[model samples]
Target: MSTRSEALLARPAAQLEVRQRITVLLTPPGLWLLLFFVIPLGVMALFSFRAASFGAQRQVFTLEHYQRFLADTSAQRLLWRSLLIALETSLICVVLAFPLAYFLSFRAGPSRLMLLTILVIPSWTSFLLRILAWKVLLGSSGIFNSLLLSLGWIEEAAPILLFSRGAVIITLVYIWVPFVALPIFAGLERINRHLLEAAEDLGSRPWQIFLEVILPLSLPGVLAGFLSVFIPTVGEYVTPLLVGGVDGIMYGNLVQDQFARALNWPLGSVMSLVMMLVVLVLTFGLGRGVKVTDLAGV
Candidate 1:
């Protein structure tokens, strides 16, 4: 046989080996997702359609839960409120994180690792503890109120500081900023330094270079970080529970109340599915506008 024919014949064996390797690598994670995520989601969907009864002799499926949710103005308001708060939180995190990320990416130099470690250290603490810390800080006699009192800024502790929608947004922004910064930092790091140098050589000012080059390139990371914060915050119940009080109640709170307090699993499932669908839609919509693959330098 000719050399080309021998190589072509061997190519099938090589291709089979590669395929086997890929299957071996993907099998564990694929099975894990099937067992945990897909199965649970399917169960939830099934429950959503079923009548809200645990020990009924007959099983009936209906769309009344969804119908009720759609008709409930209060529930719809809460859903909109939750989405707005999540959007606000994501925007605030992006605003605050961008500066820190920029500094770390371009200015940290030898102290980059140390600064990044410091930035992430607080996140290593328990999530509940962090929320509780914010609770204390915003409380009547907390450090914030005390500082305001000592500084003669207020006659008394501000009741608006804790147990409100603002409190929920503030706490969530604080919690998510570190995580948001990491992606922006990664995106910034991936930018070709030569681009900036070339811009400088072309007489572009610092602000011009940032606006023209850096901002455009780093958008993917910004979007990724925004989605990261926005999606979870929309479904957040714990932070609002601890710090938001009655005023800060979100859509997720309604779901929790149905499942835990009201024993209405079907309604909760319906709400859960609706929230998931909304998030998926928003994510897909945004994905269409800005490709997240750019964040990975793909």
Candidate 2:
């Protein structure tokens, strides 16, 4: 009957209510994930193990798909090439995005919003359209070739501009640069102006300040941007299909061929799973070394 005893007794009830509320709130999203993501992934995994047979009365599971993939040197090479391309694209995006982000964060002043809008406007258009636009620009008689011809850089149109690995990387970089910049811009915006002023007061040169302070603090955003671009680029098939020739074909194109052209769902599933695993491993491996606080210079 004491007040302390009563309060202790009520605590369990209060905890129960909180738990119930949390469960209720989480139920919908949990179910949604199970229904959509988990189920689909499970189905895909199942398909990867299933024997490659059409309209068979009995279903047989085997490891042959994985065995075949492992034995295929060309597939392995293509996978590595895709990873290399993705890394290249991500690095290029970061290099090109940083300066634009820095300017928007520090120098755009009253025009920051307008410039940012301009950066994002291109993204509002269809993704396919953007790629097609680049296709046109890189074509033999496209604007770039014409401009070069007029400038006497080349006597004839450069046929090598389009339908190459370089073209795929170029188009991907252009598509991703604005997106990458936004994250860097956000990170830069979070930086306290006082830090910059203090560095200046200590007589640090612009380059020194950037190297020691700005770069350190902006690393999280840079990593974010890099990963964002890298992950997608690794699985990119459409860009390579449209612009990249045989020499430019990536692992994604191989996977696409399995499902679309070859009608081999099991093999395609195995490839897709392998690509996903590789991406996940790389992402975690990269992220494991750097913490957000470390990147923020906190």
Candidate 3:
């Protein structure tokens, strides 16, 4: 009887060891993702289906909130405007980031890490503070105007830089610039310098090399960076609220209003879900176009 008990214990221990090893390789990441991503999405979905009374603390399951979001012309206009602004911001970010990344990868002196760090320093500081800094720099009494006046570039301070679409775009570009750069840098870094050299050796001009070897190789990075910034930028609430006057209030602002002032949770959720689908489609499309988006590197 004692021998049989000992044999059973030994069998379980080996199985437990195998299970532990398998779990060690997979469980931590799975658990973390489940806790953070899945849980938040689940909560959002749950609340999104509920009709919200907000300050009055009343909620009930209903489709009225969603119907209102779809049927209201004002809401649709706001949503369209928000999407357009976000798209503009992303395009600007991509254009600015690509060249900087290209230079950093192909040129910049040997202190590459230092250069990257410097480029990202502005981002390390407070986001709100950065936007405020833009406000001051662009204000009537700001340094930009004073400098122009001192240099005689213009007789008066240009007051055209504040509280408008231009202001919002400039601030957003500044804020999202680093996000765009890092992914591009990562993409460029993964590139094989040898392949670029080979293209050059084959009498490919610098432009040709970029068009053929560099561009294709870096597609993944470009996409990764675009999606990283684009999705969140679409739903941005703060930049629109702060820098955008009448022209700058984006769809995110509408979402906040619907929940807080309008007491419409279902509609907010629908908008959120629609935004998610748009992002997902963009991501998948980008991924398909550049299969390397899933690759370990260029």
Candidate 4:
């Protein structure tokens, strides 16, 4: 072959090699998504349209589940409550997490890693166990009540603490705060310190610097934390089951009951699909408001 012909052949071969390498890199995740996420979601979507159990004599394709969810006042209330709690949890997490994230990112100069480790260590523990521990702590004779009693803060052990809506919110906050804080801390870390210095040099107060420079810069992290906490907390079943009592029951509990106790697979699938749709809508809506260019300054 001529030199030019040889070069042309080599170029094609290199391109082909690159294509094959890219394919190899993508294959595992692609297969994983197809098998675990896409396929399962598709199956659930199919199930949502059917009115049937796992094994039944007769089956019918219907919108009964969706209709029931829409028409039923109880279901509506449950869903509303779930969303309200999730929103509350996300907001509270943001408020609580911002201070911690700020400290971890800027103030925890030497022991930052240690503090972060302490924050993360609890997440490694069994989720159920954490909820249960909270249950114990808020119980009548639990450490919290004991301390209060010793301090002469209350006349009797507070029965209202253990199995109340407040307890549910508290536990949800406790569980989700770390998730929210970590993202905010990451956002704070990515912030250019020079910006804050410039603000200070320009005679900006501490709060002013934070409001203008820090808060704006760290918004991406706050959004991430909000999404992380809000999405899962909406369908939270376990925590409410453990500590929420009757008043804390959420849509997730109904979904769980439908699947596990009632054996109403179709109904459960509908609930799951509805929750998924809400999550997708909210995510897209929130994401649309955030400009990618805004983070470029970081």
Task: Give the alpha carbon lDDT tens digit for every residue of 107-201 in model 4.
Answer: 99989879998998999999999999999999999999999999999999998898888899999999989888887888888888999999999
lDDT of model number 1: 0.90
- For candidate 3, lDDT tens digit of each residue in 13-104? 86687678788989999999999989977877877677664544345677765677678888778767777777788788989999998898
Name the candidate, 2 or 3, with the larger lDDT value: 2
Each model's lDDT comes to 0.90, 0.89, 0.79, 0.86
TM-score of every model?
A: 0.92, 0.88, 0.81, 0.89
lDDT of 2 by residue, 1-298 (tens): 5776556557988668767878999999999999999999998899898887466711888998999999999999999999999999999999999999999999999999799989999999999999999999999889999999999999999989998989999999999999889888888888899999899899999898899899999988888778878988999999999999887899999999998899898889999999999999999988664455433322
lDDT order of candidates, best first? Answer: 1, 2, 4, 3
Which stretches in model 3 have alpha-carbon errors above 4 Å? 1-36, 54-60, 147-159, 289-298
Please list all clashing residue pairs in model 2, or write none if there are none: none
- What is the number of backbone collisions in each predicted candidate, taken in the order shown? 0, 0, 0, 0
**Best of the candidates, lDDT:** 1
Number of clashing residue pairs, candidate 2: 0
In terms of TM-score, the best-performing candidate is 1
